[model samples]
Target chain A: MIAYRPREVIIEAESWKDPATAGILRNLPGIPRRTVADAGRISASRDTLILARYRGKFLKQCQGSGAEMCCNYFTASYAWNCHFECTYCVLQSYLSGSAIVICTNIEDFLEEIGRTLGRNPDRFFRIGTGELADSLALDPITGYSRRVVPFFASLPNGILELKTKSDQVANLEGLGHGGRTVVSWSMNSRRIRRSEEGGSSTLEERLAAADRCRRWGYRLGFHFDPIVHYDGWEEEYRDVVRQIFSVVDPGDVAWISLGALRFTPHLRERLIERHPGSRLPWGEFVPGHHGKLRYFRLVREEIYRKMNAWISDCAPGVEVYLCMESRLVWERSLGVAVRDAGHLSDRLDAAATGGA
Target chain B: MNITDMPIRDIDTANEECRISGELEAPALVRSLRDIGQLNPVVLLERGGRRIIVCGFRRIHAARTLGRESVPARVLGPADFSPLHPLEFALRDNLAFRPLEPLERARALDKLEEAGLLPETIVRVYLPLLGLPPRADILESQLLVARARPGLHHCLAGGILTQQSVEALARMPPESQDRFALLMERIRLSASLQRQVLGLLRDLAAGDGASWGAPLDGEEVGAILDDPSLSPAAKGEGLHEALYRRRHPRLTRARARFRERERALGLPGAIRLAAHPYFETADIRVEFSAPDAARFRFLAGELERAARGADLETLFEVDE
Candidate 1:
């Protein structure tokens, strides 16, 4: 009954001092204090709060463990903290503190990325900043995405994705980013965005922002993650499809990801404690191969059928893919289970090269 | 015929052996035998005194339908084969199938255990198709056999509870499940009892209806469910009975005002029934006409309030 405010949030990280992290820092725009340092080649910002600088080095060292390519398509932004309080968020578990973070080591970071890209000169490298922090959420205060867009525009074999739940696209207007960059928004049905996501843009705001990106010649993508299964989900999702069609043409969309509600068992308690009266039970589930709770095959197939069918009707011919789905599911539900599915790199490569 | 290479004898046949003619049969049995083959064999014991079947009752029936002379038989103690322990052997044989029906499997396990087979061996040698790992498989199977044999069958066939529901049930302590079962039984026994149980469970499950978001105490809930009202509709009527109508006059007036606004807006009356307060923001306006945009904003605002208010503690009913 009382107005709520968060208190004592935990932030966490492992292997935080990554070279790829520097590229994220160098490309960040609108940071209060920004300088291209040559000594140590690491840019430092005094205006921002530095919570922690992780020195550990390891690959794909986080929860939701999987093979390299799928997990590491984008390097860690080293920036953490999300303003939108989505109930089923990994960052809530991953972070050790609640304070906003700004990593300041761009010069060396970009240089390291340059070196890595140079070694594999013929191959394209896809990196993203949205993993640790919302890609565009902090753009107004931090201008991180704007900075990265230009750096990506100049690299021939590099692609950047700035994903967010925010409609803050004004930051992109001044940046002369070509089609080399992607501006993506995570979407859900109106009901979910209302019931689950807090401090995030509504679906219409997101789609409208996507339209703006397309007009600006930027590729757009959508992620329907943590797609909670409840009563009338089919009709609810179809309604979302109708909305998507009402806003933007399908041709401008690069990809769309459909992910079901999945999380560690421990979160069930957290969710029960946090979001009461939440009607999230679809009553069909099994422990997944990854050891997280997942929908039963039948329930999962039902979700896939409902979602894929809606996508086919509304955005025909657009690249529709599943996020972190198993092969058994891929074949039964979508009828497209490629071997390299569980890997994001494989999916990314397929997207880049236009492979189905 | 190198029958030693066979996985087992009579995978899809009855346990007891009997005489059968290939010419006579029922349509369902005929179909099963057609796919799986005749299972029961006539056992010939002790210097081959007489060819008689020790097991495979369904196979014998099917064989009689097909006019076949002999069916596959597992010879037992006559020295090596015995026909005296018909019921025990019948139970053991039925338990061998990977997809044994739940009721039959439970009854068989009960019989097998009484026949001196250790619980662990039955788990290893018997219950593989139950989809449980070796140790857990045994324990869950035994629990299934014990608590709700018929229900477990439906569950295993993926017919009753969804995987999601099972996961939820698995988290609860076994004693809690037992309590839930007892409660369900109480409701099922009588219509009057059912109404009382529904009201009690509803109130209990509502987690105090926005009152500090605490689940009702289990003892209090059980008492409410067990309480007998004057009539069947008595408990149901209590829900519509306004609480503190005289004391919270302003609360009632605000509700009436909201109802009038809702009617004017052409929204369903059901929206007013929510226990928690809800408000929607303007629907993230797309290119829309003024009227549609206004409606969208009103709906979105109401929805925004609902979303902001939802927290985990508010959703789940932790029965004390």
Candidate 2:
């Protein structure tokens, strides 16, 4: 994938005091930079990069935290937008303005995270930065992965997962991550990647990047979330599973998450306007109790059962979990009764620690 | 601004650069003029050696229809209206009296752009003033609505099309827009049904700009539309059902099978068994309304009888 080059950069006047801000700017050598008193008010386009100080808590509960059977995962949003223009992306409707906003106060974010982990030494927290943006898509310019990998390396009670669909893994090498960071990718069939997920790395490129992370002594993860249900999907998805097993060791894979394609009605309207050609939202969709449009219950059960079986065939006894699915679905598909959010979290935490 | 009795002939009514409304003839205004006379003065701009209307196109049209040579009006010359376009004056004049319709709003926005206002300014400053959100996409859609075919304008004037449907209508080719307008006239669609039919049409296309054929294309639909025995409302419903069937053939077929199986069970009239929405789940719902305890007991016995029968298994089985 081509590296992101912002047409323009807007910096919050107060953000210049942080050293990470200068480092980020140094990477974007001659881009036009404008300093504003308030970066929040400036309307941003996709080509404009806004460097602002994140005033709110840098760490937040994942948006899917409200699910009945959540993984009890958390999100640390050092950035607020993405560079990829995936047609089914929720951010197109969730976020305003087209600009990719990056929080420059990384040091403050790390300080608060360290304190939060220190307070809960006995609990395991699985945090990621991919909820709002592709975790490593902007890593080349921001070098955020380099700063984040080592920070989690020193901690014992937490694991950081960098989920991405980009191949920007150069900065991740030669870092003392200490086996704490799990660099993952959002995998889909090659057809969906080419038609729906614009600018995202190809499946081959993503698995190759995952292999590189494995060789770097860091753990790896793969998420099959938002798996589209279509004709000939079984063969393509099964092939993807086989390719993933060929590239990296399942022992080093911390967790593999499976979720069916879903979105809100509001996001569907945005898709109609922004990506008019996309037919991903057209299906036998029913509104879930949580306000997201999902495939039929039986349809979801079939997808999860097949995907779980395929993954198990290649790498049996690996950590496989669901993201924001219902307890009934888990029971019917995975055949594991996950009682609630806390129970599921415990299961994932054990997986994160390699069956500790 | 100056008020005067200018000749109707002196004003260039043929030109429409400053007009903010699409209404051409106002019979009601003509009646009002005949009954009580003009209550307010029309606004006009003196430009290019003739007077151009800034506001009150309907009022002027009514006066002309009533055979009046002139009417009382407010005329703004070059010095009086500066730092503002004539379209704003027309917009303010109408907005002060009443809200602009969807077509008028579109025209006002198009005129504002034609008057040299930047798109950003229009989105930020004018959209809210016109009671719309400051979104460029909204602006673009509105512009499409404003410039849509004349037949669509007639449909829009009838006040049946929703905002989504209006945009969809505008995006179609001119011939399609006219046929869609005619079909809409033959049927009265509720807001929800309108979206469903149009959404199905939109989804049928594998990509954008692909033709959905015609709304009255097939022989079955054409017969339904042409059938004199069917009322307009029934025609609308028939069109909706046909489109829904096309959009979800598998689901519709499965539903027919479920209904057939349900009828074969021969439960009492008081009891009803229904499948889940979209037949998404294997669980079937049993509903029975009872006014008294005795009725409830009888219904319960009937329900148990049905459950013990083997046909209950078929009711629960979904056609995958």
Best candidate according to TM-score:
2
Deviation (Å) of A142 in candidate 1: 1.6
Docking class of 2: acceptable
TM-score of chain B of each: 0.36, 0.90
Candidate 2 lDDT, B257-298, residue by residue in tens: 888888878888768887776665567888989999999999
Per-residue alpha-carbon lDDT of candidate 1 for residues A12-121, written as tens digits (9 for 90 to 100): 23213444334434444344432322212232231233423444331122343462113335455746667676777766665665455655444445556666777878
List the per-model TM-score of the A chain.
Answer: 0.79, 0.97
Which run of 10 residues does model 2 chain A get worst, by summed lDDT?
A281-290
Which residue segments of model 2 deviate by more than 4 Å? Answer: A7-10, A25-35, A46-48, A174-179, B1-143, B160-164, B207-209, B214-223, B226-228, B249-261, B273-276, B279-285, B313-319
Error of 2 at A295 (Å): 3.0
Q: Once model 2 is optimally superposed onto the true structure by TM-score, how far is the C-alpha of residue A95 displaced, in angstroms?
A: 2.6
**Ten-residue region with minimum lDDT total, candidate 1 chain B:** B277-286
Q: lDDT, candidate 2, residue B99?
A: 90
Model 1 chain A poorest 10 in a row by lDDT: A1-10
What are the per-residue Cα lDDT tens digits for candidate 2 across A168-187? 89999999987778888999
